[model samples]
Structure formats: structure tokens, C-alpha cells
Target chain A: MTIVITAFERSPDGGKGLARDTRVRWALEEVGQPYEVRLVSFGAMKEPAHLALHPFGQIPTYEERDLGLFETGAIVFHIAERHTGLLPDDANARACAITWMFAALNTVEPPILELVTARIFESDKSWSAQRMPLVEDRVRNRLGQLSRRLGDAEWLDGAFSAGDLMMVSVLLRLRASGLLDEYPNLSAYVARGEARPAYKRAYDAQLAVNKPTAG
Target chain B: MTIVITAFERSPDGGKGLARDTRVRWALEEVGQPYEVRLVSFGAMKEPAHLALHPFGQIPTYEERDLGLFETGAIVFHIAERHTGLLPDDANARACAITWMFAALNTVEPPILELVTARIFESDKSWSAQRMPLVEDRVRNRLGQLSRRLGDAEWLDGAFSAGDLMMVSVLLRLRASGLLDEYPNLSAYVARGEARPAYKRAYDAQLAVNKPTAG
Candidate 1:
């Protein structure tokens, strides 16, 4: 069955992998799965048609035959569950890998997102300057803990699995804020994730969509 | 094998079920699976012992024999995957249910959490008053879209699966804010979730741990 996923017609990030479909695309690439992308303009995303697939009216809804999945975490998880390259075979490692996936989405991503909302959506507000540091502190607090856990390690837990994939993706959001630079090991870790051939393919694919429109 | 999950020695909410363990307890109860709770004080949660299981040093963490899981979403997802009642057998429905779980955590819960941080953590900061409306508006925007999708529906999708369990859990955080009541359907939807016997069982279980001490 052909896998179809949605993406922003013009990603707000100008084709940066922050658009999340990039993660799914990367996952599919890792597993050597050929998939299709359906770009939805911002307006169409709010309409009933797209909203049915994603109640939250967000980008990156994955559809495979009758199976339609939303939430990049869940979609990536689905891909990991079905495909061979993304998850480990050992039961304990698999469970740990899944746990890391959750950590990436639920724990690590929340604070990063807070920083984003404060900087972008709330920048015009009177409180932006005052609140930015607090949000940054929270992000650093999370990164500090994560860095200690990952001390001198190659990946989060074991070998590269979907957990590392997701965690690296979550940590990448911090690049723009220059926060990841504070943790040398974490910055290097993200560099390693980006160096993966699959990640390169995914980045190039998303970048293609964002290429400057020919005049 | 017996499952051991962590919870606050005394929940900050004093048994309001805001603690992440409540979600795990609810899942176990729904599956009719007996489990044990390991209580960690606020101080203990930050210590290395707890940090080993959860890098962020928060509860609840799940341990069963050799398997240890952190993050409420991952733990709940593990339970749902292992049990039959919490998920659907149909491949598509199951995928949809998983999508709702992600939607609840990633899309819906983040804004609600921001509101909590603004009111509680940042309240003492000079920016609290000015920053609050921005946080509230972001939450309201997400809720508005969610309410539209949930119109006249009992659950997020077809039936009361883990998806509803998580969505309701996320929305419960907003109840005290009085913002949830603004949307009748969403308000009633939460009420419907609360009325479930499983929810009551879970609520009471967490409340037991949070019983106030007599002076």
C-alpha cells in the first residue's frame, strides 16, 4: 500500500525540518519506503476536509490505504512498528526505544515549544522580553538533565533507533535559539543525527519544497 | 510480571488526578490489570535514583521486571499496546486512536501546560499578567479547533479508547481555569469522560495517596 502524508504548501520555516513532516519523511527514508506528499495550504488546513484527518488542523497527517494517522510522534511510531530499520528487535531494547520516543515528544519538546511560542507568536506582546529568559531556562533545565544522561554516549540509550531519531529531531528545534550550543555534547549528538544519510535525504527533500521560487 | 509505577508521595494537587500516574492507573484499571505504585517525594523525584528511570526526574515511571518506561504517554501507550480493551483491533481505527493520543499530548496539552506555567510558575514574575492573555489565547485557539471537531461527539473518534482517555486527561487540567466551560460541547464531553466508572476508580486511587494529614 502506498503511504501518503501531508505537508504545509509553504512551510512557515521556509522548508526547515521543523515542519515535522520532515521527520516522517526521514523515517520513511530510513526504512527505504517510497511515500507521497500532499501539500495543504494554510487555509485548506482549517477546512473540514483536512480537519477530519487531523482534529488539531495541523500538518503531517499520514495515510496508508485505510489507515490515517496524525501526530508526528504517532505517525513515526507507526512507521517504526511496521518497518524494520527504525526499531530494535530485542524486547527490552524495543521498550526502551519506545520510552525514548515518548521522552522526545512529551518531555523534551514541550519546553522547546514554549520558547517558540514566546519568541514567535508572543513576540509583539509587552511581556516577550521578560518571559523569554524564563522559557529559555526551562529549556536549558531539560537539556541539562538530558545531557547528563547522555554523557559521552553515542546515542540516548543503545544503538540508533527510532528513539534517537525522535530525540534528535526534538533537540534540533533548539538550534535556532543557540541553546544547544551551550551543551557541547548535545550539539555534537545532533550533528551526528544530521550526518545520517537518511536525515540528509529528508532535509534535501524538504529544502526542495522551500527553494526560492524562480522569478 | 507485576508492573510498578511511580507517583508523588503526596501529589501537589492533593489528589486532583493531575499527576501523570493517574493516567497510568486509569489505564491499568481499564485493562483490569493489578499494579503497584512506588511513591516518590518531590525531592526524591529530582534525585539520581528517580532520574535513572526518568531523565527529567518526574513521575510516573513504569517498571516491570526488566522493562522501565518513562513519560505518561509512553507508559499509557505501552499499556494500551499490551492490552486489548484500550485499543481497537481494526488497523485503521487503531491508528486513529493512536493519533488522538498524540493530538492530546502534542497539540492540546502544550497550550494548557503553558497556561499552568504562566499562572503558577511565572505568576510571581513581572510578566505574568501581561503574558497570560497570550498564553490563554493560544490555548483557546487550539481548543476552538478541537471543539469544532468534537461537535456532538461522545469521544474524539468512534468509541472510548485510550484516545478519549488521554484527551479527557489533557482537558481536565483546564477545568479549574473555567475556560473549558466556555464551550458547552467540550465541557459536556469532559463531564462524560468523568462520569465513566473507570475514571472514578482512577481518580479515587490517586486521591487515596493524596489524603491530607491531620495536624
Candidate 2:
């Protein structure tokens, strides 16, 4: 059965690979799965059809035969469970890997998202400058904890499971902010993730869509 | 092997069931698993010993046999996978339910978390009053989409799976903010979750810890 997933017709990031479809694409690439992408314009994403698949009207819904699913974490985890490369065979190790996935999305990403909202949406606010540090500090706090835990480690746990895939993807958004550079080990950690053959393939795939001459 | 989880020595919410341990406890209750709770103070949570178990220094870390795990989503998911109940038998339905769990933590909870930070930490800021509407509107946007999807449904999906367990937990935090009340259906949905026997047991357990006479 062919797997079909949605992507932004044009990502708000302009194909910097920060858009969530890149995460799913990277997971599929990691697992050596060939999947089809159904591009959805921003307007189409909010339409009834897309909303039916993703109630939040988000891009990157997954469909395979009779099954439909959304949420990038779920999509990546589903792909991991179906394939061999992304999860460990050991049950305890696999559960630990899944913990990192949740930590990335829930604990780590929320502060980074608050930073995004501050920079993108609330930049014009009267108190933006003063409040920026508060937002950034919260992000740094999480990164500090994460960096400490990740000391001298290659991946989050043992190998580069979906946990690392997600943690790296979440951290990539921090590059432009320069906060990620504060933690040398985390910067290297994200770089290690980017250096993966699968990550390169996924990055190039999304970049191709945003290239100058691309459709 | 005995299953042990961590909770706050004194929850900030005063045992309103907003602490993340409540979610883990509720999942255990739903699956009829008896577990022990170890309470950690705020300072102790950041200490090396506790941090070894939970990198983020937050409550609700799970330990069983040789495995130690943190992150409420991961813990709840671990319990759901190990035990009966809390998940559907159907593959597609199971995937969809997992999608809702991610949706609650990643999508629905982020804005609500922003609201929490705004109300609690940022309440004293100069821009707090003026900037609240912006933070609030983002939350309302997500809730509106969720409410539309829920419509008259008893749960986000069928049969009250872990997805509803998680989403209801996420939404429960918003009750004090009055934002949840705007969407009657969502409020009712959360109420329905609270009305569950498992949820009540979970809530009462947490409340017992915070009561004046309790140690």
C-alpha cells in the first residue's frame, strides 16, 4: 500500500526544512520508505476536506489505505513502528527513545515556539524587546538541561532513533535565533543529525520544492 | 516489578489535577494498574539524583523493573501499550488515538502553556494586560478548531482512549483561565473526562497529597 502524506504547497519557512513535513519526510527517509506527498495550499489546509483529516487544519496528515492520521510526532512514531531503522528492538530502549520524542515536542519545543511567536507574531508589540529575553531565557533553560543530559553522547540514548530525529528537528528552529549556539554540545548534536544521509535526502527534498525554478 | 512514578512534593495547583503526574496516574487507573508515587520538592527535582531519572526536572517520571522513563506522554503511552484498555485493538484506530495524544501535547497544549506562562509568570509584566489578548487568541484559534471537530461527539475519537485522556488533561489546565468555558462542547468534554471513575480516583489521589492535614 502506498503511503500519502501532505506538505505545504509553500511552507511559511520557504523550505528551510523547519516546516513539520520535513520531520515526517526525514522519518520516512530514515526508514527507507518511499511515500507520496500531496501538497496543500494554506487556504486548502483550512478547508473542510483537510480539516476532516486534521482537525487542527495543519499540514502533514498521513494516509495509508483506510487509515488517516495527523500530528507529526504520531506520524513519525507510526513510521518508526512500521519500519526497522528508527526504533530499537529492545522494548525498554524503544520506550526510552519514545520518551525523547515526547520531551522534544512537549518540554523543549514549547519554549522555542514561544520564542517564534514573539519574533514573528509579536515583534510589533510595545513590550517586545523587554519580553524577548524572558522568552529566550526559558528556551535556554531547557536547552541547558538537555545539553547537560546529552554530554559526551552521540545520540540522545544509544543510536539515532526517532527520538534524536525529533530532538534535532526541534532544535533546528533555534539556529536562526543563535540561542542554540550557547550550548556547544547541542549544536554538535543537531549537526550530527543533519549529517545523516537520510537527513540530507530529506533536506534536499524539501529544498527542491522551494528552489527558484521549482513548481 | 513494582511501577513507581514521581509527583510534586507540593503541586503548584494545590492538587487541582493539573500537575502532569495526574495524567500518568489517570492512565494507570484507566488500565487498572496500581503504582507507587514518590514526591519530589522543586529543589530536589533539579538535584542530580532526581534529574538522572527526569532530565527536565519535572514530575511524573515512570520507573518499572529495569526501565526508567520521563515525559507524561511517553509514560502514559508506555502504560497503554503494556496494559489493556486505554487503546483500541484496531491498528488504524490505535494510530488515530496516538495522533490525538500528540495533538494534545504538541498542538493544543502549547498555546495553553503560553497562557499559563502569561498568567502566572508574566502577570507582573508591564505588557501583561495589553499582550494577553494576543496570547489568548492563539489558544482560542486552536480550541475553535478542536471544538469544531468534536461537535456533538462524546470524545475526540471513539471509546475514550488515551487520546481523550491526554486531551482532557491538557484542557483541564485552562479551566481557571475561563478560556475553556467559551467553547461549551470542550468544557463538557473535559467534564466528561473528569467524571470518569479512573479520573476521579486519580484526582482524589493527587488531592490527598495537597490537603492541609496530609503529609
- Please name the candidate that would achieve the greatest TM-score relative to the true structure: 2
Q: For residue B32, what is the lDDT in candidate 1?
A: 89
Candidate 1 local lDDT, residue B136: 87
Cand. 1 TM to true fold? 0.97
Candidate 1: list runs displaced more than 4 Å: none
| Candidate 2 to truth, TM | 0.99
Q: What digit string (tens of lDDT, one per residue) describes model 1 on residues A84-106?
A: 99888998788889888888887
Q: Write the per-residue lDDT of candidate 1 for residues B89-155, one digit (tens) a residue.
A: 8887888898888889888998898899888897898777776777888899988988998889888
Off by over 4 Å in 2: none
User: How large is the C-alpha RMSD of every model relative to the true structure?
Assistant: 1.5, 0.7
- What's candidate 2's DockQ score? 0.97
Interface RMSD of 2: 0.4
